[model samples]
Each structure stands twice: as C-alpha cells, then as structure tokens.
Target: MDDKAILHQYLRTRRDSLLAKLEGLSEYDVRRPLTPTGTNLLGLVKHVASVEFGYFGEVFGRPREFALPWFADDAEPDADMWAAPGETREQIMELHRLSAAHSDATIDELSLDAPGVVPWWPEERRRVTLHQILVHMCVETAHHLGHADILRELLDGRAGQGSGDPNLSQRTPEGWAVHRARIEAAAVEAEAAASAADTGS
Candidate 1:
C-alpha cells in the first residue's frame, strides 16, 4: 500500500480496536468514570471523534455537520474530552463514523503535498501538507485508543486487544468487595501521608 493508504489503514484499525473495547457494555458502563481523572470508555471515543473531525475534516475544509456545542473560543479548550448530557453513545459513535468517512474522502481527493491551512493553529504553524496532517491524526487516534483500553480493563477486568473471551465477567461479589476494600485502604493511607507532609506534621 502507498503511504497515505498505510496511514489510513492504521487509523481505521486503531478506531476499530477502540470500538471493540466498548462492546457489550451498557450505556452506564460505557460512561462510568474508571479513573479519578474522569477517563471512561465512551468519553474517550467522543474525544477521538471530535479530534478526527477537527484535524482531518476541518483542516482540509470538509468540516463535519455537527456543531461542537461544548466548545468555547477562549475557555476550556479541551472541552471535547468530556461528554455532555445531550450527547448519547450512539450519536457520538455515528459522528465518529461520519467523521472518518469525511476524512477518508479528503485523503482520497488530496495529494500528500496538497497545501491546507489549519486556521485554529498558531500562525507560524498554521499550514501543513495532507501527509503531515494524516500522520498526526493517526498518532492522536492511536494514543487515545490506548487510554480507552486501560479504562475498559479497569471497568470489568477485561484486557488485551480484539473481542475478549466470551466467558469474561466481573469477579464474584465477595472477592470484588475485598479487592475494592484493599485499594481504598491504600488510597486512604497515601492521602494521609500527603496531608501530613503538606501540614509539616
């Protein structure tokens, strides 16, 4: 395959891996914050969708139809990283699929050296070739897909790539309770030490 074709394939595979991780999850399960930092399966997917649209679609002047309702010009630039109340899992997923199609179309129509302007980027770095943007998008998608993998594993002990084994399930209730208690205890101890140090105790 050609360089653009290779990058496009890589981008699709990474996106598929992320979606596969979310299979069999209830809407609530998909949205549950798996980390203190609010990383979750669906939210990560949403963020990736926004980036695909912004980088591939907008940069090439084929912007997606959906308006980013949560975005503000000057405040909280990473607002796309979280899901808002109105954003459904299906809507986010469909938006991602559409964004992928649009981006792919842009890739098909433009040569690697085709000049495109990223107006939102800094003036000095505002312009780049289609090849540069495609490579950047591939990296961005893969990085966030890795985050989704970890969040999915923490949600239900599922790990690794591809559709996991059919028999996977949460641990028995008693075992899970013990595991939770142990982790919570460790967290409490860590917090106490930090608090004491801050107070010079």
Candidate 2:
C-alpha cells in the first residue's frame, strides 16, 4: 500500500484494538485505575481522543466544536492523560470515534505533501506535510494501545495485542482456577517473606 493508506490503516487498527480491550467491562471497570500511577482504560481512551482531535483536527484547521474540559493553555502538556469526574464513559468514547472520523476525512481529502501548521510547535516552522502528521499519530496511537493492553490484562487476566481472541487452553475451568490460586498463594508468600526481612522479624 501507499504511504497514506499504510498510515491510515495503522492508526485505525490501533484505535480499534484499544477499544476492543474494553469489551465486556462495565463503566466502572473501564474507569478504574489499574496502576498506582492512575493509568486506567477509559483515561487512556480519553487521552487518545484529545490528541487525535488536536493533531489531526486542530492542526489541519478543522478543529472540534465541543470544548475539551481538561484542556488548558498554561497547564502541563499531558493534561489529557486523566479523566475528570464530569466526563462520562460514553462521552469519551464518542469523542474518540468522532475524532477518528474527522481525522480520516482530513487524510482522505489531503495529499501526503499537503501543508499544515502545528500551532504548539516552534513558531519558526509553521507547516508540516500531512504525511508527517499521520505517521506521528500512528506511533502515538500504537504506543497508547500497548499501554491499554497491559492495563486491561492486569485488571482481569485478559491478554494479547490487537483484537485477537484471548488464549484458551484445553484445561478445564477448575484446573485453571487451581493454577491461579497457586500463583496467588505464591505471590502472597513472597510478599510476606519480603516484609519480614525488611522488619528483621
């Protein structure tokens, strides 16, 4: 495939993969932070949506009409990394879907060499080609999707990249449960040993 086609495919595939990891989860599960650092499934989705709109929509001058609540002028650049209470799961997902559509439209309408400006970048350089932006966005989307995959797995033991079927061993459910319990017991024992060592008890 050509460069534009390749980039578009990559971005869409990654975006869909991230969404798929969230399947069969309730809103609370999606929004729950899986890490001590506050990384969550729904939060990652929100982050990607904001960046998609910012890079593909705003940079191309087809800015989103709806205001982003977490966005601020003088705040940290990564403000989109977390979800505020006011933002619903449906709203975040819709924004991501809409942003993807808009980005796709812009890509369809513009040539690889079509010039656009990135306002937040260096002022001396006011323009970049559509091809450049597409590649960058593809990388960004793929990176976040990787994060989403890990977070989802940690939440419920689901694993794998993209929208592929989860692994299914021939072992029965009871066998799997026994194995899981053994692993959990081992982890608990290890933690207790480490704690005892630390305390000199």
What are the Cα lDDT values of the candidates?
A: 0.80, 0.83
Q: Candidate 1 deviates by what RMSD? A: 5.6
Residue pairs whose backbone atoms clash in candidate 2: none
lDDT measured at residue 98 in model 2 versus the true structure, 0 to 100? 91
Local error of candidate 1 at residue 117 (angstroms): 1.6
Counting clashing residue pairs in each candidate, in order, gives 0, 0
- Can you tell me which runs of candidate 1 are displaced by over 4 Å? 74-77, 162-201
Best by lDDT: 2
Q: Per-residue alpha-carbon lDDT of model 1 for 55-169, expressed as tens digits?
A: 8777877887767765557647556766667878888888778877888888889999988889888999999999999888889888988788778777776666633445444
What TM value does model 1 have?
A: 0.76
Model 2 Cα lDDT, one tens digit per residue, 64-112 = 8887767866666555776677877778888889989989999999999
